[model samples]
Target: MQELKAALERQALAEGFAKMRVTRPDAIPEAMGRLRAFLAEGQHGQMDWMAERAHWRGDPAALWPEARAVVMLAETYTPEADPRAATLLHDRGAISVYAQGKDYHDLVKRRLKRLGRWLIEEARGRGSAAEIKVFVDTAPVMEKPLAQAAGLGWQGKHTNLLARDLGNWFFLGAIFTTLELPPDAPETSHCGRCTACLDACPTQAFPAPYQLDARRCISYLTIEHRGPVAPELRGLLGNRIYGCDDCLAACPWNKFAATARDIGYAARQGSPPLAELAALDDTAFRARFAGSPIKRIGRDRMVRNVLYAIGNSDDPTLAPAARARLADPDPAVAEAARWALARLGIAIVDNPDMPEP
Candidate 1:
């Protein structure tokens, strides 16, 4: 079993995974209580799926009862350039580092499936039978906790996994098998007294160390929350039209982060002008982001986010982009346009005598 484990680790690294660790399916026993507390406090906001699959997500043993060992893998996607630099370009939209390239879901899953196939064949050749299943972020699995239990990394105060060596700039994937491989010692938190991630949030989304309120998180507001955002939070959105990476990029451990080995993760979606994104129709939006994770948000939400970014740009030249979306078919887009125009100090009155909104 130890020999198989060692060989699997070598294969995983060859497959582009930076690290791989193993643990029993039932190793994360304490995660159930933590998940319950997070959901019970309504911290997840509009992500109803978290609550829907609470049982299976909280307990990986229950997710697949026959699975004996959970193999956690990490793949680096560290940006070559400073990811936070785009936010300074007021007229351009700030895209999160993770979405700057091809969608990680497809990339990571492909590697995992290939690795699983090899494991099955390798086990059989070794006179043992093995069955395996692979999963990426799309599953109900609590990947961070599972990864920690496998000794791959520990969850930081920001509630994202960070390793002493791997840092925080990586994506996690998992493979559950019916083979009872030796389990590694679970990693303990090394965050200590650091508060860099907490202080870095533009919206103060962290209520306390290790606790996040998705309602105030810019990422959730821009990506997951539907319709117009609260008037107060709009200014805080800055020029970030997609997801926010402030917390992850702010981690000090990232100094030791590995360079991304997958050429597919190279930045293709550079910071695009807000004017260009705001003008995109449904078909244009889909075509522009065909293979990207940003396509999932659709045009309505994307344009709405662009409008909010325009509102926060502090550039009067961006008012026209906001004005063009005033009559957008989607009410959220129209509302965001009005908010942007107002923020840009532009008057919007249907009648000459009427007061500007």
Candidate 2:
């Protein structure tokens, strides 16, 4: 089992994974209690799916009773340049580093499938039967806790997994197997007395250390939340049109982080001009974000988010782009346009009844 574990680690590294570790399916026993508490408090906001699959998400053992080991893998998608600099360029849209290029779900899942196949062949050669299932972020799997159990990294104060070596710039992938692979020593929390991530949240999403309120998170507001964002939080969004990376960028551990090795994770055009992104119609938006994770939000939601950024930009030059979206078919888009015009102090002559910001 130890020999197979060593070989699996080598296979994972060769397959472009930054790090890989193993843990028993029942390793994260405390996670179930925390999950229930989070759900009860309605901290997940509009992400009701978290509550729906509570049993599976909290307990991996229950998720797959046959699975003896959970292999957690980390794939680094660290940005080449400082993501915080994008916020200063108010005329441009600040996209999260993770969504700046190719969709990680596609990239990570493909690598996981390849690794699983290799593991299956290796097990067969050893006269052992292996049945494996691979998962990226799509499943109800509690990857962060599982990763910590597998010694990948500890959940930082920001509630993101960060290590002494890898920082918080990696995406997690998991492989549940029937093989009872030897587990690694669990990683202990190294984020002692660090309040950087909490203090850096634009929306003050962290209610306490290691606790996140998704409703106030810019990432959730921009990506997951459908329809209009709450007026109170719109101004705080700044130039962030997609997911925000303020907490991740503020991590001191990131000083040790390395730039992504995969070309697919590289920034496409740095920060795209906010005016140009705002001007994109459905067809144009689809073409621009093809193969990118941002495409999942669809044109209306993307445009809506862009309008909010334009409102907060204080760049009067972008008012024209926001004005063009005033008559958008989606009510949310039109509402966002009105809000932007109001913020820019641009009088809406056509829509006399447009409300104040």
Candidate 3:
């Protein structure tokens, strides 16, 4: 078992995992309380799934009694260039670090399976048949808390894990194993007196120091939310078409973070011109975002998000792009595009005084 643990650590590091830790399957007491309070306050917006699996999400052992230990892994995927730098060009869209590359869900899961297979093989040789399962953000697991507890890092004020060495720009995955690996001491929080992330949110999603209201989060508005964004928050969203990173990029501890090693996760497609994105048809949308996580939202919702971004672009040239989308086949996209074009002063002269429905 000792040899297995050592070998697992060696192989994990060799496989490009920045940090790894073993943890007991336990509920994070402090985080559980915060989560319960957040859910009770209805801060999760239309994401009812967070509330649906509350019990299991809060407790790891309850999720699977057969699992004896948890293997938490962190992969750093920081971009070489500043992710927030492009946001200053308000006419251009700002893609979050996580979304700027190939989907981490698939990439992380495949590597985790390799790690798990190694663990199982090593355990089997030592007279134990280990049952293992790898998860990347797909389950009802409270991954952030578990990652923090596993000593990968402490949860930052933005409620995401941050390591002194890895920073907040990373992907988290876990392997639930039946082996009893020795657990490491957890990391401590260091977000003392820092309100940078909280203050930087465009929509002020962070209601308090550590609390987040997903309803107002631009990441949710552009990615998860399926319909037209609230008119009031449209301008605030800026040109972040896919996801928002105001809070993540605002963190001060990211100075020591390493650049991404896997080229597969690098930002491609030139940050995507807002005007071009608003004009994508269904086939073009799928082809462009193929193998990317953004495709999950489908063409209509994706274009709907782009239209809102166009409205916030503040560039009259983008007005024509939004106007072109006004007749989009999808009603949701058409309506949002119409709203954008109107806001950009491209509407018919007769409808000059009209407001968006």
Candidate 4:
């Protein structure tokens, strides 16, 4: 079993995983309690799926009755540029680091399954009957808490897992194995007296040091909210179209982190000038965001987010672009376009083609 654990670590690193740890599945009791409290308080807002499958999500043992050990993995996908710097350049929309390129759910899962295959083979060679199941964020598994318990990292004050080596920039994944590998010592919290993450939020999404009110989060509003944004939060969203990274960028631990080697995660064209983004029609938007996570939000939601950014723009020249979207088929987009025109001091007519402002 010791030789098998050592072999798995080598295979994991070769597969581009930055860190790996094995731990007993029972180490997440505290995290289960915290997650239950978060759901009970209605912090998840309209994301009811988090509460819908509470039985499986609240306990890892319940998720897979046969699993005895969990192999938690971390993949480093740090953005090339500072995710915060673009936010200060209000002329450009700020896309979160995680969405910079290919969707991580696809990227991480492919590699995890490969690792799982090797684990199964190694166990069978030892005449052991072992089952392996892999998961990314899409599963009922609580990845951050599982990573912490596996000793890959600690859950920071922002409620995201952070490692001294990988920083807070990496994406998390996990594999449950029936091989019963030796468990590693859990990582302890290092976020002492540091309120950098909580204070850095433009929308004050963090209700406290470790608690997040997802309803107030710009990331949730732009990506998950299905309708018109709350009017008060529109202006505060600034040029952040997809998601916000203020909490992650503010962490001091990132100084030790290295930039990602995977060019697949680099920033692409849809992260464009806010004015130009307002010009995209449904067809153009689909073509532009092909293979990108932004496409999942669809044209209406993307344009709705662009309109909010346009409204925050102090440039009057952007008014023409804003006015052009007033007749958008999506009511949320049309309403947001009207709101942007008002911000630019432009008068709106029923027709969007009523000459340039």
TM-scores for candidates 1 onward, in order:
0.97, 0.97, 0.94, 0.95
Question: How does candidate 1 fare on TM-score?
Answer: 0.97
- How good is model 4 by TM-score? 0.95
The TM-score of predicted model 3 comes to 0.94
Q: Which ten residues in a row are the worst by lDDT in model 1?
A: 348-357
lDDT score at residue 140, model 1, on the 0-100 scale: 90
Models sorted by TM-score, best on top: 1, 2, 4, 3
How far does residue 318 in candidate 3 sit from its true spot (Å)? 1.7
- Candidate 3 wrongly placed segments (more than 4 Å): 349-357
lDDT of each: 0.93, 0.92, 0.82, 0.85
| lDDT agreement of model 2 with the native | 0.92
lDDT tens digits, residues 169-253, model 1?
A: 9999999999999999999999999999999999999999988899999999989999889998999989999999999999999
The clash count of every prediction, one per candidate, is: 0, 0, 0, 0
Off by over 4 Å in 2: 350-357
Go through the candidates in order and give the C-alpha RMSD of each one to the true structure. Answer: 2.2, 1.7, 2.4, 2.6
Model 4, position 272: C-alpha lDDT score: 81
